[model samples]
Target: MSLVSINPATGEKIREYEETSQNEVEVILRRAQNDFLSWRKTDFEHRNNLLYKVAADLRSNAQRYAEVMTEEMGKPIKEGRAEAEKSAWACEYYAENGEEFLASESVETDASKSFVTFQPIGTVLAIMPWNFPFWQVFRFAAPALMAGNVGILKHASNVTGCALAIEKIFRDAGYPEGCFSTLVMGSDRVGELIDHPVVKAVTLTGSTAAGKAVAARAGGALKKTVLELGGSDPYVILEDADLDQAVTACVTGRLINTGQSCIAAKRYIVVESVAKPFEEKLLEVLKGKIMGDPTDESNDIGPMARHDLRDELHDQVKRSVDAGARCLMGGEVPKIKGAFYPVTVLADVTPGMAAYEEEIFGPVASIIAVKDEAEALKAANDTPFGLGGAVFTDDVEKGELIATKVIEVGTCFVNDFVRSDPRLPFGGVKESGYGRELSQFGIREFVNIKTVYIR
Candidate 1:
């Protein structure tokens, strides 16, 4: 069996990689485990220096990496470039702050001297997705590697090239042979990998179902797992919001990554007084967006990562419209080639509809109208997902209060789009998945928090 890479744009074949056999996987696992023994013993200074080198390498080759991402999974070249730079930032962030974050902390206990120390566990398996391929892997790898753990990536098959490129990045940066590796295999092998004795923990950035499967496998093995899963994030626009600003933010949020992001604003919940105007303004912007070749800088949207995904998104739109939601904008698939999906907007979206209930992982936005701010907030938290959300209002204090206290999501923003940052802990609640990634909290996720005491 082989893992094939297909260009979502133009529907062309890019490359194929031979799948790693069970025997080969076992060899890789054993080697990673053996290397971890030495890797975990390396001093923080040594690790930090290596990470710094990796960051420099990423920036120097950002364009080429971006091209690979564009070709492999249909990301706009510009966005792909940003993803690479963001990935480099993660490496640099961890390098600069990792040692301090993981330092032993003194505690006043009965013992004369006592402290809590963060220590690496062992080999960790990262099962990542194709959307923002580079950023997702680095976000997990940077902190895990900096904290003295090795990583083995099982990236989405469609982005196999990206998986290999990442392996090369670490290798060229002076990391040991087993420090980081990419396993070329399908999802069927995930359970086996999780069951492997060498794998001490698992981290996944994918669907809720995938997370559940991995969590089950790792749980039975008594291993830790951190899952960053699906999201149907909402962006609430209150009547008092700056209409132009709210429309811009919602459009940008919904269209980012061609709306493939787990945290992208999938649902726009607007107060009824402003719903019509918001819809009108949002429609004008959506109609103006240029969708074309990902390499083109002028294009605002690109093809989705796969044709099947594009079809699925279209089906969701069809269902929503059938359920009485108004199609305010593009709702049909483009007639041209490639896995291209047009920017679609469905207004009057309500509970139990496909657009309102499920994560539409494409360039489709569902707008729901509510009577007031209280109803808007209620609608925002009415989903099974709690990944990230934003609330827009002219009143900064009200927006801040709603974002900080009212919205139920892992991360919330006021008058802006939701995003993940290296400086902040990123994760989700409810079925969106548990545990955190990035920052001090993330680095400690795969570490042993051991307490030392003196008699």
Candidate 2:
């Protein structure tokens, strides 16, 4: 009847939350539908004002929220605080831009006048992951609320504590009672939530398998769905790249959030001319990263969110090594009680290996050596997952060409790593999931674009 939160760093109990029952879910659904009636008509200025209030609350109570995140999931304490700030930024961003994004645009027609208006549908069901819990929810909530849609969060079970805290943030910010609520339950309940007539759309950030299931459900219900799923993003190091800069960016790219990011550069494809140096430089850079307690701000790598996740990552590493990929460094699991794995580097990764073929969502970097730039492009686009990809080259024009024209991804970077920004759209291609989640593109994802004509 209750969901328990366990500390991934220390394997300790945080707290237990009562799961929402069937009856309670029905009430929640009703309230969301009721709230939408008035929420949809609220002026953008009024909505933005409330969003600004939410931003204020986020910054003021950032630490309190950070602590809960660090305890519930193994996110570093410093990163946890930053997540709070980032969430605040998202709120402010939506507050400032929602009106401009949803503005009615005139369309030329034979009639006297014509235009298209963007309007909110109803309640949106958000099934989010624990890796970047607060940020993901805020990114969706800020835009949805500003566009006049209500929200119902069904967050990852492990981080239900944070979910409850988020629900409190909305309530404290003076949103309507059902404007935003967290469902403290497991995945099995998601289908029921999505099937509710009041829930007009669904947005999920998780694995490909989960996205497909949710998409299918939403499709069957004839409801809109936006899925920001998994990614095995590739980063290419060309012969002309700045070795020092490439090494630094690639290290941070692969290791951010202990390598749990969906858009993190998972595969390192290097031309043979510079492959040896690149591999050497990458290993040297990662050697200094401290892997330990998430509570310690000094620790560069923390325990993974769960023991099974760590074990699964390890299995991937082992399978890759068995498939003829060489472990360049740190392939062994630790003796610690918590779910901890050292920063691993695998070289000679080819198409047949697990490291080359799958998404290894841990602090492990896999390297593949290609003969030339042509081969590098082939290697980078070899995977089914195409969430993001990047290229490093001293030739700026050439890098841009590769990043924009050649790489098959939702977002591509030339010199920098792939990251989500409030200004630009972010999502994926292939099996990574469809639909954008940031910028003006994201704000309009769940809105209804109705056409109006006057003769």
| TM of each candidate vs. truth | 0.99, 0.99
Per residue, candidate 2 scores C-alpha lDDT tens digits across 204-280 of 99999999999999999999999999999999999999989988889889888889999888999999999999988
Give the C-alpha lDDT of model 1.
0.93
Model 1 C-alpha lDDT per residue in residues 1-455, reported as the tens digit of each score: 99999999989899989999888888888889989999999998999999999999889999999999999999999999999999999999999999999999999999999999999999999999999899999999999999999999999999999999999999999999899999999998888889888999999999999999899989999999999999999999998999899889998898999999999999999999988889888988889998899999999989999999998889989999999999977898879999998888898899989999999998888999999999999999999999999999989998889988999999999999888999999999999999999999999999999999997
lDDT of 1 at 63: 96
Q: All candidates' lDDT scores?
A: 0.93, 0.92
**Residue 20, candidate 2: how far off, in angstroms?**
0.3
Q: Which pairs clash inside model 2? A: none
Clashes of 1: 0
lDDT of 1 at 110: 90
